[model samples]
Target: MSDDPYGVDVVACKSRQQRLLAEMVEHGLEWVVLTRRESVQWLTGAYVGPLFAPAAAMNTEGRVTLVLPSRKTSLTVAADEVLPYEEKWCSTLRDEQRAASNTVMMSALPIKLRHVGGEWSQLGPDLLADCEGNVINIEPTIFRLRRQKDNDELRMLRRANDANRAMYKLAREIVEPGVNELDVYNELHAVAVQKLGEALTYFGQDFRSNARGGLPRDRKIEAGELYILDLGVGFRGYYSDNARTLAVGGEPSAKQVLAWERVSEVFPLVESTVRPGASCKQLFEEVQSLLDKSKPWVFNHHLGHGVGLAPHEGPHLNPSWDDTFAEGEFFTAEPGLYHEELRAGVRLEENYVVTATGCEKLTDYPLGL
Candidate 1:
């Protein structure tokens, strides 16, 4: 039986492969080797490793390599850890044209390999020797192509956000005084598992408070504390991340309400100005202006960032980045504030996809006290 929770979208996978092949042809390369876990997952609709694990896990001790030829013939080498999913992996290896083709799976890299990308530092001596000077770094090319979301990718993202909404709602109901952070994390994870079944690769939930710099611990939730719940979940190799701040015990104080209002108001302002041809830096600056830096409850990071196959992707909301927002790209708008003296931290984040005229929201969870 296949362990995958979501069904593979053959059409989307093929479209991605066709785009990749076009890039390879443009660069005059015969074959492209995908070593990065994200690149591999993007090309093939297969979930290879644990969602939270880094690409290194897939590169260690006989890395799981996928070699693609210009002709759409693909090869997948599975590590010992992934051998059990051999049949399912093979089933996901057909060409982008929807033709019935056999996928070659092996335990190790071939002694004589031609082109390679990603994991250059982890290749075997023999394989590296063959691909020494000819290795092509397809990272940049793949990243550019992966920026836009196809119809299928958008659907998967929507589903992932659905789970995210459920998680935040559960957090609001369960988070209260006398509860440990871990206790809330466990309940949220259980809800994710029940909703996603085999598809839930990782349930990433951080339950922290202004008590200890937002670090999770067995510490009990106390009255008048601001709790931050940053939650994420992976669906079919795609990820959804959203966060919210809550007020514990009775109503929030005047300063706490002000911090929450400022953080909450920035997102809609940022969202309103998001459209094609808008500069990311300009949006970031606009968000920064809304923050009361003179106050102690202010965050120091960029206003927001792109979210997709990886938690943090391209089109960063930073002053240094001049990249303009484009249609079909997804991003997260997060504005946060923390006050040490008041023991209050307020953060709000939501997902949006850039469209021709404007943008569409992927996550619609209510954000308030």
Candidate 2:
């Protein structure tokens, strides 16, 4: 398997670094220290593991120390440790061969007198206290910069969407009346891992008789139950999420049919409302208006949410979502209707990218049941 499976373009990574550096300067942050795994990857394309270990340590000690310097516009990580397989991947920054031990990595910073931005949870207090300069919290500034999607990010997202659709197609063939939820799960899991040769970051199967039945306690799938498969497969570190609700037997009941139709009708409406200058809140309100009040309990969630390297990102589509949709931003529009007493639910989710004119759907999953 290729090391850089996400196929990140180096030019894109460099552009992101430059853009973030400029933003940092604009935000009055001289330098930002990155201890969170996602922040580090998003900023420098550094593939260090998650902060689970540090989180465990923090729970015990109450603090962790981390040191950061001003955004290094021209800095490049050492290439010696980077595997040969990864060398094939394109990167914008020059690759160095120098290796620094963990103990001295922080002290090696070029600037000695600068304020740093970082998360306190990942960086222990001891490290923070040991740092030589002023420390600043720049989480909000960093989040704002990372939240927006760029061209290269969109390309990678498209690739992720392609893989997600392929996996979904393989999964659909395995669904049948006698199939257990776990059975379906195992089949889909194999298709993803064996055919895709990648790990699934998120995969959930919830079987319910009615929308109000709540999530399933077990993974088993039984006939007569409604199967909801919400899955996300990770390529490199990027994630693609999509969910579908299916009826096991021949056809669904009238309520299920109506629920599916409503979701289908609402999805396009949500998509049509997305654009560079559109308001997420406005789109949400329009969708609510289309819902039949007699079935007020059908939908239990927001219209949609953004997706990227993480399964969930920004530019949430909800009544209270205040973020304005920007060109090149990507998100999901998953509208659903459910009734627990009726043992029925219908939900259709699709990933989309906001364009200059409107939006583009990423996932090609059919809207029909």
Candidate 3:
């Protein structure tokens, strides 16, 4: 079951589907079939099963079915499957054979071409045998529409941010000298399970001491060493990712502190530059310039990336990326400096949402040693 308190309104889901159907009509398409899980969820708010399995038990032979409009105007499913459509909605459950027949029936209904999304390559043979019409893919159209978030999605993303912060706080509280990397991972996992319950979708912890190498792996923290904590936590399906470098008992070395300060300063510069209509490439170049001055220990990754339904979404802050920042987009601004000679690194990341004027920082943690 989804954590969404509204319980996946079938009416609202149908409204979304109808809008897509209208788009199809405008494009000269008469009927369309959706197959991918994400596309199916966006269109009908219905969850189908066994998409990633073979054709035997899971029925990967294009068993999942959806038709835009029909004379009967009802939802249909296999006997083993459960229909998500509300009873009030024009939905009916039918056997798999009946469902496939409805697809043929809908294709014959005054529609022009048949548009299909997801597993189309697999279902093409079967569909072509039954309906003789032009078949086109709708993956790109659906992707473009779903990439940008809505207000309700932003609310779920905010909750994910809150859960992510709680996990980070737990890491800080339990991280100390003599703590193993897996130990910290377990501690933070416990906090997430206790606070968020089943709402937590994912949790990961990568801990590495500044000694040996900065690469996160199975290692134990020692006094006077640096520990890096990288975590991603989620609520519903939205995700939030954050990373922090911690100092053990004593003060961090001068080199580590300097690296931390440089990355910290760069974060605000990146955040301030993010706004609707700003070029992501230009902003990345500006941030890179600041790192060049503090050269010899340069950061080697993208300045940031979008964070929402997927941990690494879009509008990446990199020199090669040319996408423009848009309002309502949420992303992370993480900058780090690694010095192999010193075997130490410093990185600080924060989440931000692009606004009309500028941007809003989602994470408010302090960024010093």
Candidate 4:
């Protein structure tokens, strides 16, 4: 129904570009470089992968340049200038790849450049030599700018979430005793792809049962175990992360049922407590307190996090970061109790978008185990 599957919007790109320009001025930067996949896509609206997505540099004057191999340029990228270098088929970037990156990014930047950018990204050694100025970490600024979802971005994310919910529904129907973990993974992936009507850019969160979370193993799920399907669907460069757990063989032990019931209680507490100015660390403690902390049957993971171009974004629901909730941010909240007593563990996650009054729940599905 839509001509642009990635939902690239020039107006949104332009608005973001303006923000970057302002950031450049604040940092006294002549140019700012972005090589990370999501960062590039954020500025240029290009659906890029880890290997081939071009590096982007924008000047204080708003001149934007995208550098990559020629073969990857067919898609409409939003840069003002497209700089292509020679390359063979798309394989992993080797020494020659590093050289190619060095050439164009150096040309686009000043002899000695400084500004806000990803310091830990795949900048070539030669390019690093030119980054003589003190590098300013721009992630916080970038996150702030991107806090409010643009209409197009919201559309893409909503589609991914819908696909996630559909896959969960299918998982409930198909996941049972004797079903191989690989089989469930394959079916859920297929369901997501079919629901989106396009190939998934990325898909994962967790897919194994009888454990906290991991890649779907080839082992057969057991009759008395709880299968945790923390599905992550990446569509059009945006991602949706949520989870559902199911009891194998359509039956669960009393301990398993109790654990799930406890996990389910966190949702209402979250709905009542999460708001624009809440402390993420405090919120994490509140959720943590509700869970049973007995030695093995304990909750020992991040409470939740934001989801966007990168599956994990900001507004971290963990004590590690001093993140504060902001209106218009989309994130997840998951509560769980682990260990053998509860048939391995029970984890339930839900997605939400922060609103003025409270937060709008984005995840649509019944929560049960």
Output the number of the TM-score-best candidate: 4
Regions of model 4 farther than 4 Å from truth: 89-95, 110-118, 128-133, 137-140, 143-148, 293-296
Question: Residue by residue across 99-164, what tens digits does model 1's lDDT show?
Answer: 111122122344555544443533333334554447766677877788888776787778787777
**If scored against the real structure, what TM-score would every candidate get?**
0.79, 0.79, 0.74, 0.90
Off by over 4 Å in 2: 1-5, 51-102, 130-134, 201-224, 292-296
Alpha-carbon lDDT, every model: 0.66, 0.58, 0.61, 0.81
| Residues 1-369, model 2: lDDT tens digits | 236545445556556666666655665555555556566566545443331211100101112222222122122431112211111115432232111112233443333535566576556554345546667675666566666787767766676666557656865676666555556556666676665566655444343333433344434444554556666666556677777777766367776677777778876686777888888888877777776553754565787778776777778888766878888778888777766743566667788888888988777776566
RMSD of 4: 2.7
Model 3 worst lDDT window (10 residues):
51-60
Q: Deviation in angstroms for 99 in model 3?
A: 12
Candidate 1 Cα deviation (angstroms), residue 146: 2.1
How many clashing pairs per prediction, in order? 0, 18, 2, 0
In terms of lDDT, model 3 sits at: 0.61
Per-model RMSD to reference: 7.9, 8.3, 7.7, 2.7
Model 3 quality (TM-score): 0.74
Question: Model 4: how far is 172 from its true place, Å?
Answer: 1.4
Task: Mark the regions of model 1 whose C-alpha exceeds 4 Å error after superposition.
Answer: 1-5, 51-125, 211-215
